[model samples]
Target: MIKVDPDFITFEGIFAMLLSIKSKTSCGPDNIPNVFLRRYAESLARFLVEIFRSSLSQGIVPKDWLIARVVPVFKKGDNAIVTNYRPISLTVSCCKLMEHIISNYILNFLDERNILSPFQHGFRKGLSTTTQLITSIHSFSAVIDKSGQTDVVFIDFSKAFDRISHSKLIFKLNLLGLPSTIVNWIKSYLHSRVQFVDINGSHSDFLPVNSGVPQGSVLGPLLS
Candidate 1:
């Protein structure tokens, strides 16, 4: 479990976060590559810790972190169709480290309080679609053995991730009784974010992202 300090960001935590970043991953609009951070983790740790501590205290993140570079990836079907493409956003590497720290703290808090439902299998460690399927099959088999009918329904919604409401997500987090500081920081992180599409060597104008968490964000799954 990750130890939460709530008020300060530790150098060790920041260093670990920097070292954990994959070197091959693409950088965001800031162009501060992951390899750059990972290779210089030792020298950068203290600086990042101070920045993160200030950010947490102010409930604000650096504006550069709010900018994302979006790459459209084809997901089967017709590639020419816009709906068949999903955006993959790359955000500032250092900001992602801070996000990871905050996410771990939040996850630890939720786990200790049993805030998440047992039925939730996605975006959770040691659980996935396979586990959910096995659980469902066991229930169905038991019902069938008792000479009873069983019914199953599977639903897949398109653009599900892109449709999440920021306001509703914040409301739900508040309802879960998360700390006001964390909630406010998350609000600052989500709102006023901007992304620009990058295709080949060309880049589009940055547009304000008013809804949905960035596709490749550390906090995206949890917020969703």
Candidate 2:
């Protein structure tokens, strides 16, 4: 006689399905997986734009029209603890994705608006400052003589997460053509309840009703 747990059936079914799919004929780069990836990227971009709009609606515009200017204030020490600090750690792959989205937004914004001159001054200054900072700490040259006197600029958004509008995010998700099932999954995953234990061994349960996506989860970055 064999004993089987109900959980085994679910796990084995999923595993068998995945194995069958893998064993089938190879789908080239232009297959369903690639299509899904592109769709996800588009959805993520829409989500980010919604976040930016929400921030603006809440009167949380960029302070200096520069992203580098919005630096975290941290003490220069090993044991220094900054209260309420949530450091974002991104892999090189994630950084590249962010860069792509920001570059697209800048180009689109410039194309739509003829207000480049006014924005160029701060942008150039911010770029120079950023280049200097990057080069000063790293062993690299700060100045780049690319093209003929081309100016660089940077735009930073301040208090980005603090200003994220949950409702607007849902609207953007819908606008991006994400299925309701997926949207509901995201909302439930982000809004799940959690129990926390304090330093004094006191436990409290709380639900993040209006929080954006969690930053530190294994699948969080991929979903974002």
Candidate 3:
């Protein structure tokens, strides 16, 4: 995961982040919508900045921010198969704005240090699965052109996100040289998180989220 300087949460920064929110984003368990944030960004920026600063300074996220609403989205395969669906977590919009800012800082940190491998084509800006696939094809074609057959092996981990250990993730972040304050703040953000599955106007009992970053969060991909 990337690191951030909590000081980056300024009035202008918060205002810009609010404006960046897409109107179509679904509300989290807090029932706060993105369009409302964009509409009142000017009026709300100051208060949000204060709250963000306090949260970072104290190393404690607001309890409400830790809650998520999980919506299961179907993927290819039999509809009856539970594994065919992926959990899309909807979190508080205000909390996501802070995440966006922090993620940008972390990206900068990684870029400046040349920490991310050049071959990494997923998640990073300007890179995607399609790009990686194209690169692989080109490499294979070039090799075959010279009559040098290429052997390729693909491996996909099942429930990769669900298997991540929070303690180990924290340790990896520390080894990456992130500041102690930022690390502590991330710990607070990860722990005590609770979520309930929502489907067709029905909600399940709130379950404690102990491990793995949920999908559909600003920091989930970055953290993974």
Candidate 4:
């Protein structure tokens, strides 16, 4: 698995993408399209790989990867209602392929002064930090409120790791305008190489586990 910085995936790139889309298209929070945001996030992750690949290929490993021991930490924080998990091994190769396509082709097209590269420098850094600050403040405010009126809920799904329906996922991919060839490749890849370890020490091997696919994967959240 190609480990990366969890912060990079969660806040940095995501916040930047949100701000960019909002500014360019005037899609405010109330008007933002969920599907569009999903695609944007996937694209942003791919762009990040390009920024790091030159260094990676030169034998300069990413420090985050070395420290984390996983591609990125996929967490369901206090606000999360559910969680999912997929083996890192199954999706890393596909994510790399997706990154290559975005960096070499999509990014190049954007750079031609026609397409817009979503990696708009200062915005990412600024928005990322702002998001962290806002989240921290909100959490603190919730705790300090004199009234115990704040409410929180968490939902956990059973067999979440093994519940994906490949056909449904493929349909969603088609809706997202991904080419059939790429979609097919993803389906085959997911179906052919996943191994799972259960809580009871039992092990199973199959196409990517259906239920608990990794939410952090570039494609997983999009498909979900």
Lowest lDDT block of 10, candidate 4 = 64-73
Q: For this target, which candidate reaches the highest TM-score against the unseen true structure?
A: 3
Candidate 4 local lDDT, 1-224, one digit each (tens): 23222222334543344434433432211234544655566665566556444433333333222110122224455433334432343233223333333233323433554433343321232345567567656876877795545565657875443477777776765664543444544555354334333323343443334433443344443344
- lDDT of model 4 at residue 213? 43
The Cα error of candidate 4 at residue 61, in Å, is 26
* Span of ten consecutive residues with least summed lDDT in model 1: 1-10
lDDT of 3 at 173: 82
**Per-residue alpha-carbon lDDT of model 1 for 121-196, expressed as tens digits?**
8777788999988998898999999999987677897666688899999899888877777887898998899999
For candidate 2, the 10 contiguous residues with the lowest summed lDDT are 63-72
* Regions more than 4 Å wrong, model 2: 1-84, 87-146, 154-162, 195-209, 222-224
> Which regions of candidate 4 fall more than 4 Å away from where they truly are?
1-133, 136-149, 194-224
Q: Rank the candidates by lDDT, best first.
A: 3, 1, 4, 2
Candidate 2 local distance difference test against the native: 0.36
